[model samples]
Every structure is written in structure tokens, then in C-alpha cells.
Target: MKREEFEKIVEETIESLPEEIKQKLDNVVFIVQDYPDSDELKKTKASKYNLLGLYTGIPLSKRGTSYGMYPATPDRIFIFKANIERICRNEKELKTKIREVVLHEIGHYLGMSEEEVRKALGE
Candidate 1:
């Protein structure tokens, strides 16, 4: 998908977030990039095609008492459309996957562990 279209999906996903989750998402920017940054790839130990999304910022738990007061200087979430599309077989699957990716990143922002994310998704 084009950057605009991918971004639209991401926006839609954000709009669909649960109220409780959305309430905590202030000041964070969501961006769609062609691929994950080198730092992210290194962190995740992901092959180029393995990662569909990345959250590059302080997790809520790690942010401690100053969570909201002391903002992350360069807070952002990066979603990789090309990598996602390369794995998905169709539009429906793509959208589903995109939502999953978006939510997974949001889970990170919300201080959910990877295991928690899987349970939330019923995976």
C-alpha cells in the first residue's frame, strides 16, 4: 500500500482503540514508514520481513512517576507496510494484520507485555 493509504488504515485503527486505551495516548505520534529503522531491527533481532511494526519510546512502566510529566523527546510508533503486505495474502488479511500491528504497538505504549498482547488478541 501507498504511504497515504497505510496511514489511513493506521488512523482508522487508532480511532477504533478502546476508550480506556485511547485515553492514555496523548502526545504520541503514529507514523507509517517503508520499513523499520536499523536500531529497531537490531533491538527486535528481526529479519527485514519479520517485523511489521515497531514502538520506539519509553514504555509506560519504565517511564515511572513522571510518565505524563516528562515526555519522551522523540516519541513515535513506526509501522512497516511493505513488510506487512509481503506476508499477507489479501486486502482483508492485510487490514486485519494492520490492526493487529497497530494494537500491538499500542499495547507496548500501554505497558503490556508481549504475552499480554497475545492474550488480548486471543491468539
Candidate 2:
């Protein structure tokens, strides 16, 4: 999918989230990039076809009383349009996979483990 379309999906997904989860996203920014930088891809340890999205910043689990003393820089969730497109054969598959990827990355921001996300999604 194109960058514009991918970004739109990210926006739509955020808007469609449950109120509780949406409320927690107030400080995060959603960004769509063609692909991650080399270092980012390495950190994610993703296969050439594996990485579809990423979350970068202090996760909720890492925040504490000391964190409150510092000014917050917004957390970022980056969706890789090219990576997502590479694995999806059509619009329906793209949308579904994008939603899952986006949600999974945001779950990281909320301090969810992979197991937690899988259970939450009933995957």
C-alpha cells in the first residue's frame, strides 16, 4: 500500500480502538515510513519479511515516579508500508495485517508482552 493509505489505516485503527485503550494513546504519535532505518530493523531482529510495525520510546512498564519529573517526549509507532505490502496479496489482507501489526506495536507501548497480546487478540 501507499504511504498515504497506510497512514489512513493507522488513523482509522486508532479511532476505532476501545475508549480505554484510546485514552492511553494520547501522548503517542503514529508515523508511516516506507521502511525502517537499518539500525531499527536490526533491533527488531525481523526477517526481511517480518517487520510490519514498531514502537519506540519508554513503555508504560518502564515509567515510574522518576519518569514524572521529566518532560515527556511523545512515543512513536512507525508502520512500515513496504514490509506490510510485501506480505499481503490484496487490500483485505493488507488491512487485516496492518491492523494486527499496528495493534501489536501499540501493545508494546502499553507494556504488553507478546504472549499478552496474543492472548488479548485470541490468536
Best by lDDT: 2
At residue 73, give the lDDT of candidate 1.
72
1-120, model 1: which lDDT tens digit per residue? 677887898899999877887888866788887788777788797887788888878776676676667545755788888999998899889999999999988888778888998899
Residues 4-25 of candidate 2 have per-residue lDDT tens digits of 8778888899899999989887
Leading candidate by TM-score: 1
Q: How far in Å is the alpha carbon of 35 misplaced in model 1?
A: 1.3
Which 10 successive residues of model 2 have the least lDDT summed? Answer: 42-51
**Per-model TM values vs. the true structure:** 0.88, 0.88
